[model samples]
Target: MRLLFHVQHFLGVGHHRRAEALTRALVAAGHTVTVASGGAPVPGEDWGGARVVHLPPARVEAADFRTLRHLDGTPVDDTWREDRKQKLLALFGDVAPDILLLEGFPFARRQLQFELLPLLEAAKAQPRPPLVATSLRDIIVFNKPPKRHEEVLDLVNRFIDLVLIHGDPALVPLERSFATADRIPAAKKAYTGFVAPVPPSTPNRIASVVVSVGGGAVGKALLWTALHSRPFTRFADQPWLLVGGAMMSEAAIAALRDAAPEGMSVERFRPDFRAVLAGADLSISMAGYNTALDILQTGVRSVLIPFAEGGETEQALRAQLFAEAGRAVTVDQAGLTPDLLGASVNRAADLPPVTLDLALDGARRTVEILTAREAAR
Candidate 1:
């Protein structure tokens, strides 16, 4: 089946990463796929042999997401929005896909309604409208206003044909984060395990400590504290590789490299990050969805510090759950201290390697679901 996958990453690239994983899975299964990316182009991302369509990229200037800017530093005006919407409609006409998969729509990305709502409408208007679906993560932001919740329900029930949740219910159920998810029709929701790249079967050649933060734009505090907290931890003597985020400033990343504190090395990003994590003695990182899966796949001893600033609770909840499962140790970002982190590291390293019984084939399963539905058609 031909598939049109629309993805946008305003800040952190986790959304884009997960979307790409699923796209690749679809392509590997012999489906024709096209990825329509609406965010700034990542330097060296691969789409698993699928065709890509780059839309006018708009980036969030800050965490508030109130300021949108083009990559050339121009503010996004109404004219840009209109043009982008027209292009999206044109693409819909061109692809005429059997499956229309939107990443993070009603559950989030409310900011892109100008374009997304029209895209949804176009698909539904087709004489042979595609099977519309949404690709959602395990947890969404918690505690939204009552009216906002109703609005989401209305949109899903109105436009969406399927909701593919990329998580194992054994780890996190949809209702756990957004209680309103329970209201969606049972047949419309499919928990497809966690959408993550399959880990390498090869063993690691080097043993070191891996420290990373997703999207580097908002993880300065975590990386800053980590640079200094190593000495207090049990693996102070082990080599450390600190991965600087792609969005982090050059000067900031350079400063980290300079302040390596003896056995630590700092780099912008690691294409081989998963393989490195597989053989690491310990991992110190934030609790994002992809990273959580990495820790799960590698069974790496880990200390997870969930990003919890500016009313962000997604990571906090994920970290809490991961820690409760004895998969990792949690350190509160609000009250983080070098001494406290060191102690947590010691405790985490002593914990047993992870051995999960839950399904981890979310990407493949997602493709299978779409294939089966298209076949039924």
Candidate 2:
């Protein structure tokens, strides 16, 4: 079957990561999958067996949606959206998907891309092809007011075919924010578990500690603390590994590398992140969904420093949930210093094991669910 996957999240990597895993699973199942994304195209060589199309990237700020400008900061208007919608219809016409899977923003986009629903409706009306489904992570960061929530509910009720929640709903329910959370009708909702790839164990050297700030976008402060703060006051002598995500510029990476402690090593990006993860005795990271899940799935002792900006608290909330469960440690970004980061890392390192065997199977379950839906249709 031909499948189409859509995702747009400018704030974090959660949406992209979930979409990537699902598309990979679909392709592995012998289906042709096309990814229609609004973000800059992922490095083409890296997409691996799926057709990827890029539309202009966009973001919602202060309740107003603006088209992202190129280097000059010029405001490009709604024409970009119109162009993308036309491209999507043409692509769908040419590829003819048997299933259409959308990720996030139905109730969350808050009318930022209200046109997406109409496009979906148009797709459904064409040639009677493809089953429709919407996928979401376990949490939704409610950055707007009650009126936006109402708009979200209205969109979800009218267009979505199925709801695929990536995390266990028992732990985090998406509907609670809506006054009519329980009343909103969905085609079906299932917890597919957390989608994380397992790290291989065969050839890497183990490290005393691993530190990473996801994609290096919003966690610069955490990296600075982890590197500059002395975390080894307890151990007296433990080496640390730092992974600055690709988003960090070379100059920024160089400054961190130059200031590194005698036993510490710093790199811009690690292609084998999971393998690097496997070797760590302890990890220091921001509490992004995929990063947190990966650390938990590895059952590693770690310190999670959540990056809190404005009123968005998704990562902070997620970290708190895990910390309460005795699985990880959380440090607030507000007062978090290198000394505090070190202390938290040490405390987490000393804790007992947190099992993650069940969480690692999220991707397979998601594939099973999507495949079952296709079969039923």
Lowest lDDT 10-residue stretch of candidate 2: 62-71
- Tell me the whole-model lDDT of each prediction, alpha carbons only: 0.86, 0.71
User: What tens digits encode model 1's per-residue C-alpha lDDT throughout 14-43?
Assistant: 898888889888998999998889998765
Model 1: which residue pairs collide? Answer: 167-193
Q: For model 1, state the Cα shift of residue 265 in Å.
A: 1.3
lDDT, model 1, position 36: 87
**lDDT (tens digit, per residue) of candidate 2 on 1-377:** 88887767554455676777778877887878888876643322244489988766654432233444432345556686577677777777777787888877575554346457666777668777577777777776676677777776676666666777777655567663334556556556677887776666652445677888876756666777878765544643777788887656788889889998788889887777767676777778888878887677666777888777756667787888778778888888888776777778778878898664444567788878878888887
lDDT of candidate 1 vs native?
Answer: 0.86
The TM-score of predicted model 1 comes to 0.95
C-alpha RMSD values across all candidates: 1.7, 2.8
Top candidate on lDDT is: 1
